[model samples]
Target: MKQPNEKPTLKTIAQVTGLAAATVSRALNDAADISASTKERVRLAARQVGYRPNRAGLRLRTGKTRVVALVLNIEDEILGIVSPLLSGVAEVLEASEYNLVVIPETPAGDPLKPVMDVINNGMADGIILTRTQPYDLRVKVLTDRDFPFVTYGRTDMKIKHPYIDFDNEAFAYESVRRLAALGRRNLALLAPPPHLMFHRHMSDGFRRGIRDFDCMEMPLGDIDLDTPLQEVFNRGRKHFLSTHRADGIVAGSASASVALLAGLEQAGATIQADFDMVAKEPARFTEWIRPEIIAINEDIRGSGIALARTVLSIAAGHPLQSLQQVLFPSD
Candidate 1:
């Protein structure tokens, strides 16, 4: 038995229960092979000794961490979207002692390197990746090493994987359609920087929307979202004023919608009259203003719950039946 007021550990339980440390560990995990009587004895002894498994030690024995890594291949400033991503994962992890470690993506770095560094160096038990490309080599890297991971987008090569992504094409198309419905034509899209899978998806969707709604499209104004909002607004105001004049505008992201509006306001433009604006993601700023903005249902909370389920499922040794692509459709 453990001495009163002493912190309980696996070793303490092993000694007090007269069982091997491995057996104590197995019992604590509720391994099916352990005899029922032995399991009961180990449990009682663990309670008396106040023993708890050493997470580090257990991982050493089983080669698992129960800790998931959220890997990004972008700068920290772009983490506004990534923050909500983690928020979804955290909601599920809060139910248990499981934890999330966020690793920021470096600018122009090798896509597979950060995660390989984390996994090979033993920093995380599993991984969650975002902004995956259509023919991304990162998927191959993870699979080659037998690392359990899930992604936030899809791939085209013949390999199967787990992922979660929004219907970017549909959402973008819908944004334009909504603007057209308001009888405003000459729609333009302010999209994220090039080279991201979501950017491609957004562009495709925006085009489809134009084709579907028979709307006239303007120049694609791509912006570096990593820059500060004030900077984006200043630049966007100049660009919007000098470049193609648009009667209807759609901001690809929630914050971008706000930034674009600031720029438009600075230029002495009124919304719903001079131009119609819709945010791709529902932004709080859209509220408390005239002409309520239309937005997509980017449920950060649902994302959290989905990530929790994916991590726990992988940890439990169950292959996700198929790559889970749960889309929270925006209205």
Candidate 2:
């Protein structure tokens, strides 16, 4: 009998099940050649002994890490979207033997270094990429290497890699249509960074909504979603000081919307009285802070889970074509 405090291993399971260590390992891994009865016996013994696979040993034997690398933006983490996204990915990984490793990178810094590191070092079995551009070099490199990766955002590269993207076009159109229904003719859009594919989608939707609604564009100055929160606040402080006015505003994120609202309130501008704002609610906190501002839900967590599942399937030798998913926003 094993000591009560002793950690369980394949040898321990084999000792308990009266099987060879190799057979126990093959059964634990679900090897095709292993018989069902033997596998069930080994698994039952492993469960009884609380046996767990050692990742290092597994990698040495199979040349696979059983890990997934998640590449997220620093800004997204600062804005509080990282927790739920990570939770969702970890939720899926918990069910399997895989683990999650998040690698945060600056928007302006080299995003390809971590990816290349993973490829050269065999650091992970799969990867999750984000901040996808229309002509993304990262996507091109990964596709060229025939790596197992899935982007949380869409890309327009000729290669067909796996992806799970939000419906930015639909979000923009719905925001505009909702604001228009509220009788706001002059509108402005707080867009995501211009270099991303989602920005182009939003721009297309914004133009279409403007033309369809016969409304005038109230352009917000040089800043975008990537700008610092303080700067967005500073801009809002002086936004209403001038004669300019946008009766309705649509911001890309809850953080940006709140920053704008905070500065506007500090500058003595009132919500609903001065202007109405609509923003994407990935975390569902905008209404809690300010009920007057309209909030729309974005499925950030679901996107994370979808990306994980797709990449895991691809790494397991499944095709990527059937795994592409695009989530549409509701409310």
Candidate 3:
């Protein structure tokens, strides 16, 4: 309905283009059934009438909001690395008509409930999931519902979809190799929790690096990767003082990386002389140092762009065959 001073709708476009309302609707939606000429006319008429397809109304007709939700599972403190991930997602969405909604995991709720809620409640057309585990519960829920999503990392579920992951194993392994190359023995790796799939990969890479390098590593290191903030720092501080002595160190996350540096300094270990620290993600605090600490930028924005585009294609009724895994190289 066009009010006295209101703009147009699909009905107005249909009238102006001399096409059926259904034809105008389908044309505006880029439906294949609508002829080419009719689509052009509807588009031009829409322009003249200042008409834009109401996404809310379209959702009612198509049973999809055409909105992609980015879910973050930040129940723990170490998982705060997801901040830059949203920046990447926002950049991609800015170039497209699609919308990005964030679904923050509640503290006490089931980890898998948000997926079901978004899909069943029609809050989103698809989702982009981060912090995927080996047997991710959210993936299972979304798959059972036949919903589309892209993961920040891979899962063990035999089914292939869209994903953008980093080479965690290679990065972890090479970090150790670099230390070994520098003649730094007694290495300690501050890794993510074993529950995370990448944790396993990184640990394997680190071990393989040491064995291949013939470091005679005791494997008596603290891998308190993903834990409470205070606990991780406490363990790192204690580990640096008493046992787990290492000349080379790898901090798996930003906070852990900074904590290890601070802990080592407090324990009378001088940087470069006693310990060479490497961070998995770019650290803010390390900027003020004499020599910048080596770090691997997660490129969360590029990963987010990949995820956003995949969800859009899926929602647009395109074949999912083009979807592929994107694995970044280790720095």
User: Per-residue lDDT tens digits of candidate 1, residues 172-260?
Assistant: 77888889999977888877666667778788988888887888887634465444577768865775576577888877777767777
Worst 10 residues of 2 by lDDT: 74-83
Model 1 TM: 0.81
Estimate, for each residue in 219-312, the C-alpha lDDT of model 2 and write its tens digit: 6788788988899898888887767768888888888888888888898999887788889878767777778889888888888788888888
What pairs collide in candidate 2? none
Better of 1 and 2 by lDDT: 2
lDDT of 2 at 244: 71
Q: For model 1, what is the C-alpha lDDT against the true structure?
A: 0.72
Span of 10 residues, lowest total lDDT, candidate 1:
282-291
RMSD of each: 4.7, 2.9, 4.6
Candidate 3 lDDT, tens digit per residue, 1-331?
4677976777887777777898887777768887777777776677677775567887878776757898886556442456677777887765444568889884445768778779768888889987778888887777777788888888777766577787788887778877888888777777876767788877888888888887645342544755556666566566667654777877677677776676667767687887776777633444455244567655666677778878878777788666776565445
- Ranked by lDDT from best down, the candidates are 2, 1, 3
lDDT, residue 327, candidate 2: 92
Say what the RMSD of model 2 is.
Answer: 2.9
